[model samples]
Target: MPPTRVGAMRRRGLFVSGAIQRMRHGPAPGRWILLIGVSLVLGVALRWCGLPAGFLLGPMIAAIALSVAGGAVAVPRVPFQLSQAVIGCLIARTITLPILTEIGAQWPVFLGGVFSVIAVSLIIGWLLTKWQVLPGPTAIWGVSPGAAVAMTLMSSAYGADARLVAFMQYTRVVIVASAASILAAVLAPSADGGGAGSWWPSSVAGRGGTLLVVAVGFVVARLLRTPAGPLLAAIVIAALAQDLLGLKLELPLPLLAVSFAFVGWGIGMRFTRSTLSHAVRALPAVIASILILVLVCGGIAVLLVVFAGVAPLTAYLATSPGGADTVAIIASSTHVDVAYIMAMQLARFFAVMLTGPFLARMLTRWSGYHAADRA
Candidate 1:
């Protein structure tokens, strides 16, 4: 096969692997419906049982992680991972200049988190490659502060092994989120530390409408092929629209829980038997590469917090190199600066998108693999 064709074939496997995973792990079609229905029921029960606010994503993430660990369900496949690319693309429509200005205006808080994580991800990638734990391209992309899904997709697009990318991306996020949540619980500044944290709008329905708007905006953004930056942007715009229109957005708590459950289900679908069995033959290196990246990026976040003397907790929350939106949600429950987290997350995202391919090329040259091998 031509090198390009080889690349394409590997790229195609990203989706194929996921389907095969489902076939092996998932129930028959009739059972799948029953499982999904049960999931919805459980999600609703959890939401109604007085889970803390802004924690809908937590349950879903837990479901995905638990399923993978306990073997209750198949690991998600590449197609499901690819589906998030569409979500990212559609979410691009959320951007507006006002939203940029909103976050950019908080320059000091934003820049601290952004540069800190970038420096960390870069240094970590270099170290893993030096240690021979990972191929350079895999290490570079693995440590990036961008969206987990985005990193995986870009890696696939560049002809990196789809299974490795998916595993590393999801694993990093799982570690980062779990660790951050625990740390924040133990060490977060008392809720009353500052002026009682600013009051969030009480209108749940209005908020849900904003989410609807964001979802709609994403569709348009994807159709336009706009970059993914706007997913948060669209949320901001919708928030603005809600305020301007004085529309009180009321979100049903149970409904919110189900929404995130779907997202988790989708995320879980990224891995399967193939992803673990054949695909993970090379995972020892990949896992080592990721652990090193975490330590490095995490250290940067700690340093940034100390240097900035910002609320170490808030700065730390904002600085961790996880997904923009996911991090923002975590910060919300912990009462960190939601805008700051969102901003820093976006900065890291653009950083990964712009640099992932170049990193892939550099690693290929250094590691004895042809760049063309990265499909």
Candidate 2:
């Protein structure tokens, strides 16, 4: 109320404002502030709209808009890594002994389905090259039905257009994830079996045990040079501990939201007008290939339903063409048979990761195309 008090309050306010500006601007002020502020605001707004995976969608859209506008923005790796770990934890919690037993019993069916998916994906790739929609290697890598990021990273080495491949791969992820979520909402409203909770253990001993498992997982995944390292590690550790050791670990809702936001932002930030224009030009071919793959995989799902005796939703999930990470999230959110879907997705992922390079080379050579050496 007095002059001294008012002066002091003003000084304090200025100090706080300066600190915030420093944080928002980082080393470079104006653009970074805009990027962070817009992303945060949009992410929250999307979450408020009750959108499934709104946290991801909002930030992603914001990042894409900024990128297209030629704004300099990048989501650092730490947020993305934390997100991966959170998702890994969420996925690990879904695995259980009963699910493992069920999957083990149906190994024959899984084998058949995995083979079918690979065979069909290759066919789609061939079709793209035949139509001259893309180059041979790009077509192959673009339509590989593997994890988007992994496949994209491998694309250049295999003589594919890495930018084009990334565009195609991530676009399909967005489409498939959106469509699957919508379908689940409409057809299986009760599928979501999870809700918010803290993953921390109650006692110090429990906390130590949980951390130990996660740390071990992180180390193992890194050692193996796995893509999405922390996530894969977390999933492996969580699942083994839960199923074998009867341990329970979970990620809280807020943490899950933040992770989703980071992953979404990471994908969206890859876009620019040049890359997007290229993607649009190739959209017709890409969409056709994806459609064919989905339909063929749908047939595989039918077999899963009839022979494996799982629900139609579960069958469809097991055979979803891409987005293994997204599939796990959808499975958990919709409460579809998590174990079965994850098992099938994992089967396809490993198959593609282990054999994708060799197969790409073979197919290119067989088609009378030489694989390019960029390294």
Candidate 3:
């Protein structure tokens, strides 16, 4: 009775399906252009607003939105690895002989503070798992108070959901950075006078050397096949070169922006609807854990004030569970002892980077054992 109508309907359905498929996979150039444009706009806006890691966060947010809306575009592996290496080099540039000496002078204080943060992170991770908020070691890595990018990449390497880890890491970074900035304003309003330097490098030689180090680091990481090997290798090599050989490592603004975009896109494009939903649901617990950490670290800061005789702001900045880069900015903008805060932050960074993987594994196992016992 309706053969022609049915045939026409079938062809229309096929046409719609083909169009959807083409949109997702065939329009590569258009998708890239759109994604890059959106990323740039957001990145610039956020940077202008003075948010921490604004470039990275902007691209991340853009990618997440596009991904959830079915316009996802993937970042290639080589670019992502290069991005990680670049970030590693950036971290390395901050590790100078003076920072090392400072840490060495107060080894006990550094040790206690760094371990206290790590232990609290472990406890939070364990509780997340016990509460069944995230699966396995993902919770452990998510709550680790390390360099956010480092934690996210390392967690992905260890088979945790990088998307979720990135969510947790960046969320805490934003919160902690904001809190530190507020505290800085409240404590020393007169000291907030520092501005960022020029984005271009002063020396071409330094930039070349930095690139060479990153290339070597990439190769070494490939050889080692370790989790986040590229990043770790770059950090070690660049730090050695900078501190021991007195080489200046420079990461220009443009280069850093592209690298940050690659990393942000890499994490953002991996999100599926399911992961996004999980992240949304787990966000409350994540925020709660972060607040608890901040409070506990504040208590630690008070101890530093009383016993170590450090300035309150310096102590707080040093102990704040945010990214080292963000903390450095806050320290610089305020009248706090920038070197001391950085030293403390770097000490904690190294400690977390060295022990994070082992702790994640141990906690995962421990959590699993408890789950089995309950069963």
Clashing pairs in 2: 191-334, 191-335, 192-334
- Provide the RMSD of all predictions against the true structure, rounded to 1 decimal: 12.3, 7.1, 8.0
Candidate 2 regions with alpha-carbon error over 4 angstroms: 1-51, 190-216, 371-375
lDDT of 2 at 203: 59
Error of 1 at 200 (Å): 16
Worst 10 residues of 2 by lDDT: 190-199
Q: How many backbone clashes does candidate 1 have?
A: 28
Instruction: State the displacement of the C-alpha of residue 247, model 1, in Å, after optimal TM-score superposition.
Output: 5.1
> Would you list the rank order by lDDT, best first?
3, 2, 1
What is the per-residue lDDT of model 3 for residues 1-375, given as tens digits with 9 covering 90 to 100?
Answer: 599999999999999777655655657776677678888998777656554455666787777777777888767888878777877787676667787686688889878887888888889988888677776677889888866767888886775778788778867776786687667666865321222223788988898999999999999988887655676688789989998898888877677778778877875776667556769877888889889889998999999999988899989988899876556545644566766776677677878888988888788777763433332
Candidate 3 weakest lDDT stretch, 10 residues: 189-198
Ten residues in a row with the worst lDDT in model 1? 189-198
List the candidate 1 regions with Cα displacement exceeding 4 Å.
Answer: 1-109, 130-132, 157-159, 187-212, 225-230, 242-249, 278-285, 363-375
For candidate 2, write residues 1-375 as lDDT tens digits: 999999999999999878655554455456556666776787666445433555566666767776676663678876676567667777777788877887888888888888789888887786676556787678889888857889999889767889889888877777767666666666565312222345543556545665566567667766787787777788887787878887767455666666776787787888877887777778888887777777788888898888878799888878888677777666666657877888788888889989899987777776666544323
TM-score for each candidate, following the candidate numbering: 0.67, 0.82, 0.71
